[model samples]
Target: MIQVEGLTKRYGERTAINKLTFHADKGEIVGFLGPNGAGKTTTMRILTGYMPPSEGKASVAGFDLLTQSLEVRKRVGYLPENVPLYPEMSVVQYLDFMAELRQVPNRNERVDEVMEVVHIADRAESFVSNLSKGLRQRVGLAQALLHKPEVLILDEPMEGLDPQQQIEVKRLLREVGAAQTVMLSTHILAHAQELCDRVIIINGGQIVAEDTPDRLSAQIAGGRRLQLEVDGDGDGLLAELRALPGLSSVRVVADGRFEIETAPGPDVRPLIASTVVGGGWKLLELRRERLSLEEIFIQLTREEAEAAAAAETGAPLAEGQAPGSDSAAG
Candidate 1:
């Protein structure tokens, strides 16, 4: 478990992170998502005791970050964006060194366990310099898990690997996250959408949004379309549905299928079902379409940037107004 409150970091007059606050519950996999220069790495460093925050408070595994840095570090396993590894050391040798440095009991056994977890036991004898980028990443992960920390803090764990390797790492993270808390920062939206139970989106040194992937998607998209399959001609049904209150638009997809768009509100399936059954049409299936995480991320970040710009220029944003243009917000 982890908690942060009012976490701020500054270098000279430039602020990297400003008043960041969030929490990762025990056994929860929370994704830390942001674009370049969004203070993700800065926040991770403060959490890992790699650097102290300029102001704020934090706790890791129930230990105070400021007063108990060592205890917090002991419970956290960190894999940085650019892994710091000894190129000349063999996989087994490097893990052994890390285990010893952490003062882990039964160092050999722990090393073997982590090597197996990351599927790098076969490369135990290979030098770090000789392994492929993916294998090297595995080695980095193994070291992080060597101590059996309660919390895993990963920065870009899937950054440079091939597709297959990325899949493999995601599987490993899922397996580990089943028992330990995981806080990972990644640029890959699809990966986050697949692996994270909750996502925190940050921009301009502040948190712009935080919620489950599904909720965030629905919130940004505002409304969704419904797909229906019936056992009769859909032309009559389409016209009738379009005439329903709160129904925005209706289109026939095929001889027996239709797509219905609705205004943002409660589910309209009950009304649609009653109308179909009452009219002697068989309602086979009805499903609502949801937006993808990519679409949600783009819309949320762009809105945040536009709001900031509006504030700076003292421009009044109209009620219910959407963002003006598609700019690279990140």
Candidate 2:
């Protein structure tokens, strides 16, 4: 388990993280989602005891991060964005060395156990430099688990791998996270959606959103989208649908299908169906469209950026204004 309250980090005049607050419960996988330069690495470093925060309080597994830094480090396993590895050492040898460094009991037995957990026992004798990028990543993970730490903090665990490798690593992470708490930092929205039980999105050194993927999607969607297939003149149906109250936008996907965007309100499905029937158009199919994690991520970050810009310019943001529109922040 981990807890951070008002955590702040700075590099001279620049604040890397600002008044950040969040927590991960025992055996939960929490994703730290952010774009480049969003201070994810800084936060992770502070949590792992690799660096000290300029202000605020944090605890890991009941130990205070500041006063009990050593105890905190002993319970956390960190795999940075770029894993540090020895090129000449074989996989088993490297793991053995890491186990010793961590003061793991029965170093040889621990090494074998971790190698098996990461599925690198097959390459136990291969030089780290000789292995593929994916294999090397596994080796890095093996080292992290060598001591059976209580929490795993991973930064971009799938950074340089191919699609297949990414999938493989995701599977491994799911298995490892079953019993241990995991705090993963990644810009890959899809992977975060797949792996995290809860997500904390950071932007401009601040937390913009925190919740489960489904809840976040529902919150950002605000409006509903519908796709309908009608048997009639496409242009005529498009015009009629556009005339409906609360409708925002309409697009024709093909000869018989139309995509409709609507504001959040009462059910419009009945209205849409009746309109089609009233116009003598045969309605074939109708369904609501679900927003993907990527769409939700983009919308939340854009809104936060616009709100921040508005604050800086002493302007009031208007409802329904686009993010970069002059009316929103000028």
Candidate 3:
């Protein structure tokens, strides 16, 4: 488990993290997502006790990050975006050394276990310098797991890998996630959407959104849409559909098709079908139109920028935080 309160980090005059607050429960895979220069790496470093925040406090596995830095370091496994390695050391030797560095008891068993976990046991005897990029990444992961830390702080863990290697690393992360709290920071929205139970999207050194993928998408897009095609004058039929409760806006598109928004937490397809039949219109097609994660990400980023500008001008953000939603800006 991890907790951060009013976490703020600054370098010179620029603030990298501004009053950021969030928490991840045990056995949960929480994705940390943001655009470039969003302070994701900064936050990870502070949590790992590699750096100190300029303000606020944090804890990992019930240990204070500031006062109990040593305990926090012992409980967190950190895999930096660019994993530091001793290229001269063989795979087995590197892991063995890391195990010892962590003061892991039974270092031999721990080294062997992690090597197998990351599937680099075959190259145990091979020097790290000779391994491919994918293999090297695996080695980095193996070293991180060598001590069996309670929490994993991985920054861009899937970066620079081919599709096959990405899949392999993703599978390994999922397995590890089942037993430890995982805080993965990456720019890949699709990967986060697939692997995370909840996503924290930060922008301009602050949290702009945080929720499950489904909830986040619905919140931004104002709920999902249902596209329908019926054999009739779609114009009047669109109006009739809009008149129904739980149905919001309706647009009649080309080819007798209509795009409609439905109320949250309700299935309006059956009602639409019945309405079409009553209107003497034959149904042709009907299905939900879900937005891609990329679209959602773009929309959220733009919104955050606009909100930040509004704040600078002393204007209230038209869409500050939705009810029951956490939204912040620089």
- Which segments of candidate 2 are over 4 A away from where they belong? 232-235, 312-330
Candidate 2 local lDDT, 160-275, one digit each (tens): 88998888888888987999999999999999999999999998798888889876665555456778888765559888888899888989999979888877676577788889
Give the candidate order by descending TM-score. 2, 3, 1
By the lDDT metric, which is better: model 1 or model 3?
1
lDDT per residue for candidate 1 within 237-328, as digits (tens), equals 77778778878888888898888887766656778888988888888887666668887777667877887877754322122422222111
Worst 10 residues of 3 by lDDT: 321-330
Question: Which scores greater on TM-score, model 1 or model 2?
Answer: 2
Q: TM-score per candidate, in order?
A: 0.82, 0.90, 0.84
True-vs-predicted CA distance for residue 295, candidate 2, Å = 1.5
State the RMSD for candidate 2: 5.7
Error of 2 at 125 (Å): 2.1
